[model samples]
Target: MKKFSLFGLKFMFEVKRSSKNDVELYSTSYALREKIIYLILIMFIIAFSSKIGLLSKNNNYSVGDVVISDIYAPKTIVFNDKSAKEKIIENMIAQSGKEYIYSADAGRIYLETFDEFFDDIYALKNNKDSNVDFKNLEKDTGRRIPDTMVKDLLSLKVPEIMKLQKETRKFLENLYESGIIQEKATIKYRSPFDKKIEKLSNLQRQVVETFAAPNYIYDEDKTKKAIEEKVSQINDQYIEIKAGTLVAKKGEILNERRIKILESCGVYSYKKSLGIMMANLTYLFIISTLFYQIIFNRYKKDILRKSTYRSTVLIIIAFFLTFRFINNDLIYLMPADTALFLLVLLTNTKYGLMMISFMLFFLLPIIDYDLIFLVMNIASMTFGAYLIKKVNTRAALIAVGIQMAVLKVATFGLLSFFSEVETFGAALKSGEIIVSGLVSGMIAIALLPYFEKTFNILTLFKLLELGDLSHPLLKKLSMEAPGTFHHSMMVATLSENAAAAVGANAVFARVASYYHDIGKCKRPQFYVENQQNGENPHNRVSPFMSNLIITSHTKDGAEMAKQYQIPREIRNIMYEHQGTTFLAYFYNKAKALDPTVTKEEFRYSGPKPRSKESAIIMLADSIEAAVRSLDEKTPRAIEEMLRKIINSKIEDNQLSEADLTFKEIEIIIHTFVKSLISIHHVRIKYPGQK
Candidate 1:
């Protein structure tokens, strides 16, 4: 006996002398499609992610360094008018009776008093210590400025300066919190004047305020003299606010060699953020492929077949592993949202949920997540996928759009719990969230058809369309050979149960059975069950002609299936069932006419049944016909008939070519024989009936 292993089953489809040229090309094309799509989708995902900051650009500078010069201005210094300053000054003067010295000359103010301000400002610069600028009060003011007064003044003015800075700092902080600012803001403030105002520190608020104002009135001669003398004395003094990008100088260039120590830190940070987004997006494509293939394999013929829980889990695992190679390219093509959409469209709710959680990580660089954030994204993606999995319209794509909104809210909510971001970041306003979601939904709707056609994903909706028995072939089967149609249905039930028991695809079994006997439609009256009048067309025909007609059904079925463009897997069962067995009745009659007749002439020329499902259908067809001839269907008689028939086939090696083993055959025979006997079992005879 010629024996082959599981791998050999695939080899039969290869281009060999035995296979049709068309079938070989078709098989090769299908294999190419699988490999090409996966590679293309993966590459697209990585490319897209790189475009969205999910991947970093290697540059000569780091975050605190200037990428471009003169792009940003120094922090501004705005002061309240004299009226506001005078009010505090007058209060200070009235509170303290100490004699106050004043300078009305603005030049003197710049030369003498401005020095103190500059000193204070300079004290703030290059400290890298505390953020405050004012230095030791006792030393600067010679004990005139009390510690309490300095503290109180700085407390008031520092807060005011911070408030003045509120807008600029707000943007910086927003960027930082959102992972936009890769580094903290570097700040500096400096001034050239320092000595003049240092004497006023010990004075009460009234004195300090009175003298601090530049607009105070005084004698004209005295003011002019003070201004001239001070202006001439100090020509070089100036104030400078030096706040901008901080870059490494010549001496710091040596740090480049040591960057490896911090490279992991940067990369880790990068991976945690954008890297995650990259990985997840890449993962999403992988997950989607696994889902599409797994479900495709199971339900390719049925159209409406769903993924099993175990298969779904396998898809998640396969994709997650694929995610390990994720780079910027994956993020560029398929973000978390797009990946989620594809998964939901191809597979089930649970799979979508699983994938969405994985996708959240894909956007990690852009949307840094903690535990809370992770949970929210997972929930949102899962919910979104669940919402649109069964939706058959553009409106359902809106549900996918809601996923983007869900992502925003989910991200926001999580951040609110764990981050200082109270609402959407300044970059992402409430309106923006709505718009993004709506846009995403539109994208999903737009891309769905392309993916379906390109990837050959036969969704449930497509399955529903195919399942309608009103299709031309099914209609012909019903109208022309109603008996065979009924037998096909019964065989479908048996085949589906058997396939399911052995972890095969039940939906494929059922659908394949429906179309299996389509060949009988050409000669409906010749087949026994379809002949309502019990008229035997074969009675007048020679045994050889009768054999020719009977054997033609297999060829006829295969030809019709090809015309219909049925999938190869389904068509395989059609061609292989009945397995070239002898047409016993016709062969015997022919043998009687010619004693030299050979049995080989009567046997079918077959590419024998290759799978368990096809082999079972062949057995069931023969058994169903044989059982009908019984006068009584007792358990003992049924068992004897089933065992004898199966054992004879076993001895004849009819089941040799298929994957089904002897043990499986025993179980199949026992199950089927029991089912048939139970259906036809007779009740005990009543005494008077005879």
Candidate 2:
């Protein structure tokens, strides 16, 4: 029977050990976890890219309608239906040689130079005595020389009048060269393009009513040769089109069909528009990188712990893709603040700044104009993040509301610069943006508890809050079982020191200390600390019952911790702080009475402390309780107590499963003994002290 029992116990022991191993094995499958995150990120990028048509090629064309006219007027003037040509000619005539036009009847006039005018009346005719004043004639003409005449004359576009002037100049030069009029000859015309031929007979110089080729003009043969010669130069000025493709027409609309062809030819369809968007995207990336480096990167681990890169990537992709359906407004929701708050609960200022920067990047392609609003959004998020960073309780939800207000005001201020918009409208948009941030932040806050429960990412800040001395359970322990509470507090001090010395979580140790004795509150009188009236309940109970009561704290504490939704990390410590060990004091007392009491019946069943902090607390609790019994609270007594406790725990195989090394244990023991002796040492008394 004994051999069969031993075999059965060994089998049960193996099963328990295997179960604990399984728990730890699955807790750290880091490689598979990271792969899953990356896969999700890629899927999100693809979805967003497709949504915005970012994967598809697009193009644009510029076109305008032009009219044909033969009047040879400036395009601007023709379009406006203004007589700019006549105005220009009139201005030119004012600055012409005095002899060019004399007395004019409506549009027709006689012309002569200043010298000719002088000679005909004052010099040659010698009518100077007859008041033939040239100055009077010039004043009577009412035409003044203008400063811009030369420029207007050069720019004049009357092709026919220009031809006439050339012909007249040729005729006069020929007349003088052939000695037809030996004296210097001069040609006259109503205007530069309307020359009056003097030597040609009326028949030869007939003014053709219809457009006609001048006799001196080139014939078809010569004209064709001249056209061919100019073709090369003209061709260079025209837009070249390949032989098979149709040339683009002016004012043509680039419909879908045309755009497709253009894209196929490696042409940029949107012309310059794509360049601007790409530039904005690039700028956004730069700004985001800078902001993230400065603000978000510092707290990267903490932020990413909750806001996984996979989720951020997915949200960014979703926001980017939304650009196809809409623009600026939608993109604003994708930035660092939104992503951080949505994906993670920590709304720190650093994260807010990073989120804003990221939002700017996402907004680049979506916000076609007015970048100031994006800046405002960023500022608001930064403020919100700062407000929520230090929130340790659920009331931190107020920070979210405050953040919304900041966003609204900042956004309104930014939008005000561009237009005198209605304050209500600005206020409304601001409110919307703020609300979004708050909603997202609230969601994050709600998830925080679940995340902590599922993942044992116990932060110090959270542990400190959980360990508050005034917490209901701790208060109960203090009031009902003050002895146990005081013992727990001493254990907390020793365990905290030991944990820190071993480079473990001291806060976890301290928190575990408070709740480690919580089970004693159920039967406070049975424990010595709460037996103030000196009625020892254990004296009347069987040794087995006493052991059951003492050991049941682990079970009771575990139940209470679960009921309160205490995190698994804290709960685990409570379960493991005191590994199954013999309660020798009560067991010895029972053994003296019956001499047959089983030691097994006097031991508390345990899970054994799994983590370094829990293990340290267990040792500290035992050592502190043992050292308190010393007649003299000396350094040697404390040191011996610590050594015995540690050695006993090791001998019982309690510390074997823990991660703490021998080196760390040694350090912990030294630090704990020193601290304990310091606390208990007697200070030198004054002169009268005995």
Candidate 3:
């Protein structure tokens, strides 16, 4: 008997090991499938973003081609011709003339000469020589004078000559100081002693003429610099092409101005089409590769599903097309934040931020590399995503929208402060940005339900809605199977605590647990929790039949969840909670009746718990049911029971597929023990107790 028991034990151990291996294999296959799906989705997005404009017939138009208006400008957009502006500015600079710079040194030279001449006059006057020499005066004055004129000057008294010299010096000083001594300046003088100005001798006229000199010197360097500075101060000139103006007629040849207008309106030339196509393809490849690398490194699990990645790609594509088709003036109102909001709702904040950044890069060329538009939209989208990240109510979206608008306005103002462009029409642009943010938020809020339904995504709002106990399915379960409902509530409590302790999704666990036992409502009388008045249904049914009834609950619950349109994640937990675990009581009874009965016959049909949340539900469900049946309700007994139940699941390899570490499992155990103690805690009876 001992040898036979050993053989049986070994056989059972092998079977359990094989079952664990199967779970691992299935998990690996599922993960591989998810990765493949994600790869295909990424490829599709890359192809879509890259080939968007390349395939269009209009993209083939060249500079020489005659084109008609397929689409008209929606408003009177006044586009500044960049090339024309550059040319106009250059012409303005070229036409500016050099300026003449005046110098004070010429005036100083004139004054010094007058003072020296006056000193000479005083020297001759104070000398008191018996005879004044006219020849010596002529030499000192540095001028040739006629002999007759010199003799005539000598004939005058010393006081008369001194007075004449003083008068001449004063006249020359005034002339130089007045800045009239230019290149063509001339000086004519008349002595106070001469009765007629025309009667003055040639020698006297020569003396006065020698003092007249050009004071102003031409400064080539200073003139050139002054002209350059004046030119630099002139603002850039632009050629404004008003909307509704015919840039080109049907047969008119396209000039540079018309070409600029066409380019501004998003018409491209086919002359460089190949180069443009290559550049766009290269950019798309680089961005797509980087995006994939980031997702693989940081958000592998979050975007592993096709639906999640596809939804994000679709949002980006939708926005891209919207911008492509809309009028340039209204481009700001394209609802950029809508993509970010959906991304946050679908994936997470980090992924949403990364995707939006990539989107900005893609939009740069399309928007004519407008940094203001790029920065404003990026800031608004980021703020919107952050504001709504933790919000769980639809009403909160309005507040987020308002806050996003305020943030966009502030962002626009800050950007405008640093902008080099004139702020003449900034009020209208600011209004546009504000409207864009507000309208974008409203649109996002309006379309959120549609996106959630279409993608079958479980956002925070959806999770909250599912958590409501008054939900139709939960209410039905409550009325049909009160015992199972109570059990579900207990499991939900346990799972929530354990999930929190292990740093898992607590709300997801709670909501999933609330609906995990809905299948029991179909036949509540068969379950032990719903058994009435000392009656056991298992007594009348065979173990095989009982196992079938028990095992069918997981499949039934999944179908019921589907009927109510529950999210796939929650339905998955319902289907995976049992995790191929055997109905131990029925299995034991069957083995007692017939020793040939196999443990596999009592096991639930399961692909095993494939996530932390599902695994947590599995553990909580078993613990709650086991603890409820314990007669000896003490802290020590409950702790021991919890350990044994956890150990059994571990040995059975039910949790092999879950991404839980040993440390997390230990934390879960501690949490479960504490919660069970509180639930089964003994209370002291007062004196008036029955």
Candidate 4:
């Protein structure tokens, strides 16, 4: 034996040595061990792979690669766009080149150069050509310059130029050094420096104001260099995107810029979808492990022996296939409740609840984990399953549908409080929910007869139908053997109470009790119950003939049930009701005449009571007959007769095959005592009879 742990669960496999060879078997989850669920899971994967996008179309995606689908930020993304950083810095420096700055050196240089300009003009005047024409300046050989350079230069009077220099030169130089803005707005800061403004006389201020040139020059290279340095120290161009932001759309080109953004978010590729598929498949195994126990508790013994498995597969196919074709929004209209009721009717509530568990798993991937819709449907489905447990009429199914619809409406209303939609919209959606809920029960009842006939499920509705006195066989029994019919009804009534007390199917007990003696209709006059004139056919017949006539009723009832197309469950009850209880009167008479008489020869054919309901019918039938024969109509007499008859059954091993506890038998005895006492209560003696 080898034990290993996988997926948080331990599995053990025993390697057995056969005579031929050693064989190794792998241990796996129930879903895999049971090929049915494994096949269903395969179908699930194949059918919904594309819908849920479980398989990856393309996994190996890189930067600048376009995606096949929209990707979203799984978490907050914060990253610098490295590709856009350099270009952004370059643009910032180019814009900074236009700014002006104060340059005192350039201002002083201009003043000195102006004085040299005066020296050149005087030297020209001192030359032989004292009347130097400005027009001829363009052709001058030694130091030719543009006329604009000296446009104001030639206009200045000789003494005036010296005077201009004397008054403004000192102040203008200081002003330029202090800084004159060509554009005041270009200055980086508005706060003045600590230096005081130079005091100027009226004439000094006038000359300086009139003659000051803009010395605040823009050094493009210096400004560009400064900007480059400042921007280099600045932080990287980082972007912060909130969670769930759309990172990219399908087929969108993901350049380096977008790629950097994608890197900050969670990893996304087509391969992730493949991981989803694997994870969901594992979850399906978990779901199966959780439910298959209760669903198959009595699997082969009960409804599964019928067509329960086939019906289960059919429901699964119908649900998944319908969702595959119809709009997912219309999933509410699929009548899942009908499937749930069918399962409950065919098996039991616990099995139906187990199926609901399976349905929950089926719903997860189909609804894409829409919890609201999931809750709404599961609640309504469970409610309808429990509803059908007690109701036994076709008309009552309409009431069940109404109750389920009310449940759905209530669920939707509670859920709507969170969304708070408009009145009309909420009402409309609620109406839709109501319709969806009602569709389940309405359709279930409509197809119930077909399900019963096809699946061989004996539902409470079917049982009630069979118990009706108006049925042809039942009507014939009442007419031909009124006493037998009355006896059967009493047994049914008493058996129903006992079955209910013992937690058995009371409806089955009652319905089966009604038909347990239908064979007596064939030999009504031979039985004591229908011997209207107290005639004793047994007195006329030999003991062997009487035993044969009386013991044949069990098989006779079974045969009659088949002839009338009764459900096998009811037919089995008729055969097992008598078990092999010895007919003491006939057997004793036979032994008196012939010394070789055997108990088995006088006993009914012995299948014995194999179910709680059948065991209950056996006890109820015997007790009712014994209580009827008691001369004293008293509670003490009825109790003694019930205990004596029930004890006789117990001593004879009549209930050995039944699944009844001692406590359940006690409860059945107590219930029978109360019911029999009420049935045989002392009546008023008639005037002449006393």
- By lDDT, the candidates rank as 3, 4, 2, 1
Pick by lDDT: which candidate is best? 3
Question: What TM-score number comes out for model 2?
Answer: 0.47
Q: Which regions in candidate 3 have their CA more than 4 angstroms from the true location? A: 1-174, 180-209, 216-304, 422-424, 687-690
Give per-residue CA lDDT, model 1, range 466-570, as digits (tens): 456887888889999999988887777667666766655556566778877888998988899898766899998999999988888888988887787655556
* Per-residue lDDT of model 3, residues 137-233, tens digit only: 3455545545554455556677777776766666556555554423323332223422333444454444445554445544567766776776577
Off by over 4 Å in 4: 1-269, 291-304, 412-428, 685-690
Model 2 residue 547 CA deviation in Å:
1.4
Cα RMSD of all models vs. native, in order, equals 21.4, 18.9, 13.2, 14.4
Query: Cα miss at 301, model 1 (Å)?
Result: 17
| C-alpha lDDT values of all predictions | 0.55, 0.56, 0.72, 0.70
| Candidate 1 displacement at residue 206 in angstroms | 34
- In angstroms, how far off is 148's CA in candidate 2? 46
Candidate number of the best TM-score: 3
Q: Between which residue pairs do clashes occur in model 3?
A: none
